[model samples]
Target: MNSKIYFDGSIMTAELIGEIDHHSAKNARMEIDALIQQKKPAELRLDFSGISFMDSSGIGLIMGRYRMMLLYGGVLRVVNVPHDLERIMILSGLGALDIFERQGEVYECT
Candidate 1:
């Protein structure tokens, strides 16, 4: 997995690239968790435009981040999910959350 995290004050944006599978889930989660703890963002955006594949591990990653952010009263936004992952998100009933298609941008929150 390829990833980078950018933070502007309390707003953190994580960009995920390449395949999101068991192979990279551990490292990815560590890095993202580190960033989240360091930044303590009021809002976190997980950008998935560059993610080509997402398996069950990816689902776990999403849920983990969601719970982490919720603990701090933070908001999580998933953005640019491709067709297949979008289908999964929809089927999993995660579309009710703040997953963005084309309208993802920097957002500030309390």
Candidate 2:
């Protein structure tokens, strides 16, 4: 998997691409974590639009980033989730975390 990271003031967005499996998750984690540790942004957004495939590791990635963001007193948002991947994320209990902000549906974070 590959990720393109963007920074806009206090918000950092990581646009994830390709397959997110156990092998690729580590690299993705490290890349994002490095930036988080350096920038300590107020918000982090994970963009899933370019993702072609994903497994449980993808969920782990999101959960891990969520925790890291919380530690930094920042908010995490999962955006542009494909329909199929959205189902997987919801089934994995990610839907309950208040991290998703789909195109047509909005999830309130509280």
Question: Considering every candidate listed, which one attains the maximal lDDT?
Answer: 2
Q: TM-score for each prediction? A: 0.85, 0.93
Tens-digit lDDT string for candidate 1 (1-110): 98988888888988999998888988989998887887678998888889998887887888899999998889888877776676666656565565454455532111
Candidate 1 overall Cα lDDT vs. reference?
Answer: 0.79
Residue 54 lDDT (model 1): 87
Which residue runs does candidate 1 get wrong by more than 4 Å? 99-101, 105-110
Clashing pairs in 1: none
lDDT of each: 0.79, 0.91
Query: Would you give me the overall lDDT of model 2?
Result: 0.91
Error of 2 at 52 (Å): 0.7
lDDT of 2 by residue, 52-84 (tens): 999999999999999999999999999988877
